[model samples]
Target: MSGASNSGAALGSLLRQIIVWVVFAAVVVVLPHLFTSGSSISMMSQMGVFILFALSYNMLLGEAGMLSFGHAVYFGIGGFFTLHAIRAVNDGVFSWPLELMPLVGGAGGLLFGIIFGSVSTRRAGVTFAMITLGIGSLVESSANMFTDFFGGESGISANRVTEVTLLPFSYGPQIQVYYLIGAWTVFAALLMYLLTRTPLGRISNAVRDNPERAQFVGYNTTMARFVQFALSGFFAGIAGGLFAIMFEIMTASNVGLIQSGSVLLMTFIGGVGVFFGPIIGAVLITYMQTALSGFSEGWILYFGLLFVFMVMYAPMGIAGVIVAHFAPWRAGQLHRLIPVYALAVVPAMLALAGLVSVIEMGYHLSLAYDPSQPIDLFYMQVNVTRLLPWVVAVVVLAVGVALLKWVSGRIRERWNDINKTTERPEAAR
Candidate 1:
């Protein structure tokens, strides 16, 4: 009877998972209909690439506890190779589906990962990071030297429209490319997630948490790290292939320091401890790049400030913050945080306004044609050139900072009180 009940529960759990995946697939399929524009489709395609890229990165940083400063090398390698493959297909060298191109990139990434991981996995932590950085620098320099493959500064470009596929359709339209990306994104994400359930994945975590213990327990720690690194590279390469397919171009910058840093920022800002964290971070950052950069030249400044703010106030990243609140919400004490959070908003907004104003004023005086032009503040124009405005902005910033510190202390105290009140008596005793 107990065995039957256990089997039933397991079957129910599997059904739930299937339902959830079906819903997610439906949402992905429906999104393009809602945002039916070439630009929007392109943006979503990029988001799909980034989602895989960031998640694969989490396999290293989150699962294996490996910090790679040059992960983009794998991505670029895969992209360059995939571009060549696409061109070959266009030239009628062979026929292959555009959807299968990412697999080629994955193969390239896996090969390089084995070569690089062999030497680097010997040392962990900072040493591994430095070695990876050196390798990245070497690859970037080589891209120019090997212009035949990398296509020099101009890079390589191909027409996905000419490639023969299993289907009668050419991947000419952005919507076609978007669906290709979406399908691959789902596949890569599912594969990576399943990898976490395997013995190798579990042991990788064990090695991450305590390599010495993992070794003592009869596991080869170095081998585990190497395998994990190789797998991460493969997935990253897959993402790179998706990138190439979407953009139909591969460049030196694809594997450069900026690309490496972007993924690192996304992974870190997404909460490295959580599996789904990078997905959220990837989407948020990609959207910001698409939408925010268009708003002003100072968009990078705003992005940098937001990153710093998250690092300072919420070190766990956005997903972590959301997860933190789940306990209170489940306990019905979420309402208590409403007023506390509202109080925090005033200081946060004031500080943001003042800092943005200062940045704008400096940019205006140094770069803009007219320094006396009124800068928009909350939709209201303020003459930033005036001494009074400068003084007021600085004062507001200072006051906001001071008040924020005080209010934070009060909230912390209240938070502790609430936790104490909500504690289970049996455990407390």
Candidate 2:
């Protein structure tokens, strides 16, 4: 009876996993139909590419506990190689489908990852990070020196709509590109998740948590780290291939320190503790990069502020915060916390609104080409010269901060009580 019960439970878990993947696949397929815009498609394609890149980074940062400041080395190299392959295909030097060109990028990324990882993985902590940074700088410098391959400042471009495609559709439209990216995103995400269940994945985690113990247990810690790094580069390279196909251009900036830093920001902001955290971070950050930049000059400042806030307040990340509530939810105590959460949200919004006003005003004063020109802000023409708007914004910000402090105490007390109640049954068990 015990064995049968275990089998039944395993079967149920497998069924639930199948359902989740199917729903996710369906949503990816249906999203373009609902949005039906060129920009939206383009944005989604970017999101898919970053989602894969961020996940690849997490395989190092989150899973293997290796911090990389230069993962973009693999991503950019993969892209550059893919572009060259695309040119070769276009020239009839080789026959290959556009659908499989990302594999070329993956191959390129893997090759470099193996070369770089061999040296970088020798040391585990800060030393590894520094080595990667140095390597990234070296590659960025080489891009200019080797203008033939790197294309100097002009970069390289290729037309994706050649006769080499396995799919029915020509890979010309943004919509087709979006679908291709989405498919790869799903495929890669599944593989990464599966890796977490494998022996190498477990050993990687062990190496991450305690390298000394991992070494003592007969695992060559360096080899484990090297393999993990190379595998991560493989996926990152796949993302680069998708990036190349989507953009049809590769630049020196793509492989630079700035690009590497951007991926780090995305992974850290998303919540490295959880598997899905980077996905949330990538999607949100990508949206902000694309959508918010059009509206405000200080969007980068806002983005930085957001990262600071997340690091200080919710270190677990957006997904981590959501996951935290599951215990209360399962215990039927979630309803008790809802009202407290609602109360806190009001003051938080007020604080955000005020902060946004101040930021916009500051940008207008400091960065605007013409300070005399009235700026359209939040659907109202606000003169920077006028003092009333400043006064209003300050007052609102101060009041919101004050109210938030008061509400936060109540929220903490309520959550503490709920946690105690929820834990009682588990304690008994």
RMSD of each: 2.2, 1.2
Model 1, position 63, has a per-residue lDDT of: 94
Q: For candidate 2, lDDT tens digit of each residue in 116-199?
A: 999999998999999999999999999998988889999889998989788798988899999999999999999998998899
Stretches off by above 4 angstroms in model 2 are: none
Stretches off by above 4 angstroms in model 1 are 1-19, 426-429
Name the top TM-score candidate: 2
Q: What is the Cα-based TM-score of model 1?
A: 0.93
Candidate 2 vs. true structure, TM-score: 0.97
